[model samples]
Target chain A: MDMTFEIIGWLAGICTAVSFVPQSLKTFRTKNVAGLSALTYTVYNLGVLGWVVYGAYLKSYQMVVFNAVCFAFSFSVLAMILRYRRRSRL
Target chain B: MDMTFEIIGWLAGICTAVSFVPQSLKTFRTKNVAGLSALTYTVYNLGVLGWVVYGAYLKSYQMVVFNAVCFAFSFSVLAMILRYRRRSRL
Candidate 1:
């Protein structure tokens, strides 16, 4: 096993997992997805769903756990944005 | 081979790849990372780097191409954030 790849995996996993912070912060702070694109969120949500399955198939806990958390967070933000958008439109 | 997985893979692949749009948009539109976290971006950049390698190892073109594009986009945002952060602080 290449130790470098292992390190890479951990690094990538953590980074990808944590990368959602800005959006979350923005979502929380602004309480708006005014500038955010709905299409992007929809696509991302689908992607996270994919990661979940991909990780499960690979039997890699790292992929599964990381993507799961990321998915939850993304979903939360997406929901918030959608709610805010709907309320604003109404 | 499960066709379901292939569909899921494409969905996840596209979702994950396109998911960066909001961030990219925010980065470009806002012209600031004021609300964004540097640590998160740092970790994410590293994660994209790992994905590049992981994709290569798995010989999955979806992984490689999607990650490569995402990496470039993420790196661009990261760089912009760093530059903006520095300018504002100075």
Candidate 2:
């Protein structure tokens, strides 16, 4: 891959990875996941995991790191959603 | 790129692209975006747009197509959130 493409990929990864911050913060603060769909998040996390595997196969360190962070953020949000939902039901 | 890497990329892209469907469906069904963060969606859209640009640069048709679909889904969710927030305010 060219240097330009590599740089662009990093930029893209950073944006996507950081984008989850606000949502996670909101979920943590509000504890309101009424509009959040557990199914969608579960599927999204699977996709991120796929990226992690792909990154490992390609030996792209940046891809692996970014996707890993994204996966963590997504997983946290999912966990929070589940916790809040369970609490609501109880 | 190796065929394996390319195949993996395609699979990852498809997974991420299609993952948005359930969220979009739920949003439309409930018209409830209270748990969805407009900030996150907006930022996520930017990241997807970055992927679209990167794909164009790479001449990767699969990347372009999948990111395009993902972008549309994310944008629709953001728009719905904005609309709902406005209506709630009114």
Candidate 3:
């Protein structure tokens, strides 16, 4: 059971990380922010911050590591959106 | 610190759960899974399953509760995708 939990933890962490791939790819490929929502990503980054703090408090390396990666991914996505949004307005 | 962690945990859980909203809305409105990848979602579901087990092992209520909600949301989205894919094919 213990080993099972560890395996599950690893799978969960990896999946959660990998789940961002599609959007990342789309953003990278299209360089378009037309479909993605600014508000959503803003809240997402905030959420990531909260998660990182929470994970640190709990002393959970999995939570900290994964949320930090998510933060970086989301930040990049947000930057892309802002850049495209600005470019479109120009 | 404990209180702070609890607050952060709540925020993280809510954010993670809320993150699914845009995709759900898009899927609901467009009835289009063309942009969404089935493989991504399949892996997401598996990840959610793993998180549930890991959370249980860690005795973390936040993980179990939030992931369960996310699981339901993702399941609905997946079902919608399947239905739409079938409809589109015909």
Candidate 4:
């Protein structure tokens, strides 16, 4: 049971770590922030950065690695949103 | 220093918990999934659920609380994506 829970945690970590891929890929290709929220990604990236730092403080490699990957993907998406944001629709 | 990291982790958790709100609200209002990724939210929801269960096993209320809030917001977004996704845009 303990091992099962551990596996669940590990899998959960991986799921979140990689989940940003799809959004980043689609945004990268489409360059669309029409439906994306700048505030969401902005806060999310800062959270991930905090997590990375917290993980480092905790000496937890799993936390650091997972959040680092999320940061990379989410930050990329956020940057794209800024780059391609619709300034004015006429 | 330790307390600072703890505070960081707490803040990080709160940021993640609330970060989904803007996206969900925007998607709810605009009914746009053009910039949203179904797979990302789908996986993220699953991951958050897993974290809730993992927290239960670990007897960690913080994990459960934060992730449960995230699940609520993110699931709403995912539902919006499925509901509002355009089909056969011609």
Q: Residue-wise lDDT of candidate 2 within B7-58, one digit each (tens)? A: 7777888888887888898898999888888899988998989899898988
Best by lDDT: 4
* Candidate order by decreasing DockQ: 4, 2, 3, 1
lDDT of 3 by residue, A1-90 (tens): 788778878978888767666666767787756645566578777887888898889898888898888678767778888998999899
TM-score of candidate 3 relative to the true fold: 0.79
Q: Where does model 3 sit among the CAPRI classes?
A: medium
True contacts kept of each: 0.63, 0.75, 0.55, 0.86
Best-fitting candidate, measured by TM-score? 4
Please tell me how candidate 1 rates in CAPRI terms.
medium
Q: What is the TM-score of chain A in candidate 1?
A: 0.89
Q: Rank the candidates by TM-score, best first.
A: 4, 2, 3, 1
Per-candidate clashes, comma-separated = 2, 0, 0, 0
* lDDT for each candidate structure: 0.77, 0.87, 0.76, 0.91
Stretches of candidate 4 above 4 Å error? A86-90, B86-90
Q: In candidate 3 chain A, where is summed lDDT lowest over 10 consecutive residues?
A: A32-41
Model 1: residues with Cα > 4 Å off, grouped in runs? A30-32, A87-90, B22-39, B82-90
Q: Against the correct fold, how does model 2 do in TM-score?
A: 0.91
lDDT of 2: 0.87
Better of 2 and 3 by TM-score: 2
Candidate 2: where are CA atoms >4 Å away?
A1-8, B1-8
lDDT of 3 by residue, B1-90 (tens): 688789878987888767667767767886756544465567777888788888889998878888887787777777777889999899
